[model samples]
Target: MCKHILNAQVSIRAPCCKQWYDCAECHGESQTHPLAKTAEMAFICKKCKKAFRKNMSEYEESDEYCPHCDNHYVIEAKTPQAIVGVEGEDARVDNRMLKDDRVKQSTNRSLFTINSDDLTDKVG
Candidate 1:
C-alpha cells in the first residue's frame, strides 16, 4: 500500500477536471488551470478509489472500505472545526448560522448535500 493509503488520507478530487490527484500541489503541478473551489470538491480513497463528500461522513465507519476498490482504512472521528472559506486574500467562516444551536451539534449530517448523480459508485 502507498504511504497515503496506510495513513488513510484520501486523494483529492478535482472538480474542474473531475479527476483524482494526490494534493493541491500535485494538481497545481500537473494541470494548467487553477484548483477548484473548496466547496466544490471531494476526496477519493487512495487504495479503493471510493469517493467521499467533503464532510467525510461516508468514511466515518470504523471498518471503512471502498465498495468500488475494496481498499480498507481506519478513520478516526475528529472534532468539528470552523470551516473557513478562502477566496483570494479574504478568508472567513460564514457566521450567519452561528446563532443556531442545531448547527453546532456534532452529527452525521453534512453541511452540503450530494446529488445522487454526483456519486460515482452505485451500491445497488
Candidate 2:
C-alpha cells in the first residue's frame, strides 16, 4: 500500500477580464486589473468576500463603500480620508505604531484606488 498525501491546491482568481495579456491588465481600457504604485489603498468588502484593488471610479467619492462592490469610483467631489481619531483628542499614538510593519491589511483585501491626476500607472 502506498501512503498518499493529498497536497492542497490553491486556486487563484485572475481579475475579471477577457484578455490575458500581461500589459493588458494595466490598460484602463485594455481590460486588465491595474495595480497601485504608491500610497497603498486597502479595504475589506462584505459583499465581495475578498479585498481587491479598484480605481477611485469604483467609490464615486464615497470613502465608505468598496469599489468592486460599488462601481463608479469617481464623483464630483473628493472623498476625505476616513479619520480614525476623534475630535478634540489630538489623536496620538505610541512610537510602536510607526515601527510595526506587522500591522498590515489582509492579503485578500483589494489595493486599487483611483486618482484624478493619475489616469494610468505613473511608475510604468
Candidate 3:
C-alpha cells in the first residue's frame, strides 16, 4: 500500500538496509539515510510474492517482468496530483463544492401537446 506509486507492482529490496520499499521516495521517507545504489538489485513481486534479482549491467526488456508470475513490474510510476476541481473528491462531499450548473429539463406540457388523442383526431 504505497501512496507514492499507487500502481507499483513490485517492492524493491534496498541493498543498504535490506528493507523492502515500493519506490525510492518511500525508502527516503522511512529511512534516515539515502538509498544505496547496487549493480544487482533485488525485488519482490507483489503478484507472485516471489523474490528475484537482476543485474543492472545485463538487464533487458524481458527482465522488466517477474520471473515467477510474469507480472510486469517496471512501469511508469503513477503519482498523486493536485486537482483544482472536485474531480478527485469523494462523491458525498463533492455536492457541497460543486454548483448545480446543469439546465433543468422543463416538465410543463401544453394541453394540446398532452392530449395526443385530440391532435391525432384533428390530423386524421
Candidate 4:
C-alpha cells in the first residue's frame, strides 16, 4: 500500500516508441529519407534482455536467437496461440455403420463399381 502510494506520487516516465524506416534500396546513397532503420524493437526476451524484430525478416536479420542453444526464434505478429477446451458431447452419428455387413457408399446413395478392398466379400 505504501509503495503504491509513493509510486503514484512520483512522476512516471513513459518509454519512447521507435519508428521504422525502409531498407537501403528504398533510401540508398544520395537518398535523404528519415530513419532508414528502427531505433529499437518492441518484443524483448527477459532472460537475454535483448531487443528482437518480430516482423518477417530473414533469419540473419533476427537478434532473438538463443546463443546458449543456438536455436532460432521468431515472434509472430498477426495471430497468437489459442487454447481450446473440449466439452463432453455425443459425437457419433451412428455406430451401426461399422457393424453393417454390406459396404455402403459414402454419399448414402449407391456403392460405386470401382475395384476396392473391404467392400467386396467372398463366400466359401
Best by lDDT: 3
What lDDT score goes with residue 55 in model 3? Answer: 98
> What TM-score does structure 1 among the candidates reach?
0.36
**All candidates in order of lDDT, best leading:** 3, 1, 2, 4
84 in model 1: Cα distance from truth in Å? 39
- How well is each residue in 14-42 modelled by candidate 2, as lDDT tens digits? 34433222122233544435632433333
lDDT of 3 by residue, 20-123 (tens): 99899999999999998999999999999999999999999999989998999888988889778535577686667667899997665455464654464343
lDDT of 1 by residue, 60-114 (tens): 5643555566565446523335578744532345555344456564454443655
Please provide TM-scores, in order, for all candidate models, with all chains considered together.
0.36, 0.18, 0.68, 0.22
Off by over 4 Å in 2: 1-38, 54-64, 71-124
When summed lDDT is taken over every stretch of 10 residues in candidate 4, the lowest stretch is 6-15
Task: Note the clash tally of each candidate.
Answer: 0, 17, 0, 0
Model 4 Cα lDDT, one tens digit per residue, 1-92: 12222211111111221322122222233244443333333443334544444332433554456443434443332323467965544448
lDDT of each: 0.59, 0.38, 0.86, 0.36
Candidate 1 ranges with C-alpha deviation above 4 Å: 1-8, 55-124
Report the Cα lDDT for candidate 3.
Answer: 0.86
Better of 1 and 2 by TM-score: 1
Model 1 / residue 77 / CA error / Å: 18
Cα TM-score of candidate 4: 0.22
